[model samples]
Target: MTDPAYQRLGLPVTASPFAVLRAAVRALHPDTRAVRGFRAARKRFYRQMLCAHAARQAAGDRLTG
Candidate 1:
């Protein structure tokens, strides 16, 4: 199954949890420190990270159960 979160993070659904987290950190790192829209961008980044984490959990569950 193709996970949209993995696709957004440029990872495979079978990726390890550590890999997912590493990718999330790398992806979430902001290129700019602009004060404008910083709050909204931060919120989006956190949301994406959560989605990636959830995808990793779902993948692990499928493997274990």
Candidate 2:
């Protein structure tokens, strides 16, 4: 089965951990940095993205390690 974390991020399962992390960081970037409430939303989203990436990494290790 594919890692749902990668799927959620629209990345391939074969993507490296660095790629996943970069993607997660890139996702938080916005064209305009002045939106109201963006700070709070980004914080929550960042947490979720970290959790998803961690889950993907753990799952990959289980499958291959």
Candidate 3:
């Protein structure tokens, strides 16, 4: 069976947790990384996603990633 989280993130099933997060940050575009607002938003978004995913995993729920 495939990992739902990785699949939803468009990452390989073997991807590490960090890789999944990096992908999320990348999704918002790297060019905006130097912008303070975008940088803060990206960090918040990544943190939220990571926490949510981990919570779902702990609950035995299959995340859509």
Candidate 4:
């Protein structure tokens, strides 16, 4: 079966999920002045996105079931 996580991000099965998530974070926060700051923001943004995605998925499942 296809991974829901990959589908959620609209990435191909062969793509790295971490890379997809990193690109998303970069798109959201595009003005980083330093590597450390970018890394920190990326981590925080990724966590937030993942949590939001999971919540939406769970809610959809609940509605459909």
Candidate 5:
């Protein structure tokens, strides 16, 4: 299954945790710096992205909580 989270981040399902965090940070940057309240929004968005990624990972038979 292809994940939109990975698609949006231009990454792969096999991407490591470090890679996911880095890509998310990169995507959130600049906007977070220039816009007011953007940091909070970015954090919220990143959480959803991570949750989606986790769901995809779990689909591969790796259990997560």
Candidate 6:
């Protein structure tokens, strides 16, 4: 099944995860290092939440404001 969290972020889970992440990062116009750092940070945060709680709890936080 596709990851609902990614879908909520407007990402297609059907595509390769890295590709989706790279595209999203590029859309932000971040430098290569910044993109890598952001991805690393996201991975760490999600890992901690998943280990301590659940994937649902670590859901994507989308701000529309």
Cα RMSD, each candidate: 4.2, 4.0, 6.2, 7.4, 4.1, 10.1
lDDT of 1 by residue, 1-65 (tens): 54455467776656666776677657654554345668676657656666766767787788899
* 21-65 per-residue lDDT for model 6 (tens digits): 554444443464466657776665444433333333333222222
TM-score of each: 0.47, 0.55, 0.55, 0.52, 0.64, 0.27
lDDT of model number 1 = 0.65
Tens digit of lDDT per residue, candidate 2, span 1-65?
Answer: 54454466786556666777677667554653357667786666556666676677788789997
Clashes of each: 0, 0, 0, 0, 0, 0
Tell me the deviation in Å of residue 57 in model 6. 15
- Itemize residue pairs with steric clashes in candidate 3: none
Minimal lDDT window, size 10, model 2:
25-34
Comparison by lDDT, 4 against 5, better one? 5
Candidates ranked, most accurate by TM-score first? 5, 2, 3, 4, 1, 6
lDDT of model 5 at position 5: 53
The number of clashing residue pairs in model 2 is 0
Best by TM-score: 5
- With a 3 Å backbone cut-off (N, CA, C), the pairs that clash in candidate 1 are none
Flag regions of model 6 displaced more than 4 Å: 1-10, 31-65
In order, the Cα lDDT scores of the candidates are 0.65, 0.65, 0.62, 0.56, 0.72, 0.45
RMSD of 3: 6.2
Q: Which whole-number lDDT from 0 to 100 does residue 5 have in model 2?
A: 43
Q: Rank candidates by lDDT, best first.
A: 5, 1, 2, 3, 4, 6
Best by lDDT: 5
| Residue 25 lDDT in candidate 3 | 68
Per-residue accuracy of model 5 over 1-65 as CA lDDT, tens digit each: 55565578976677777787788878765757578767787777777777777777777665543
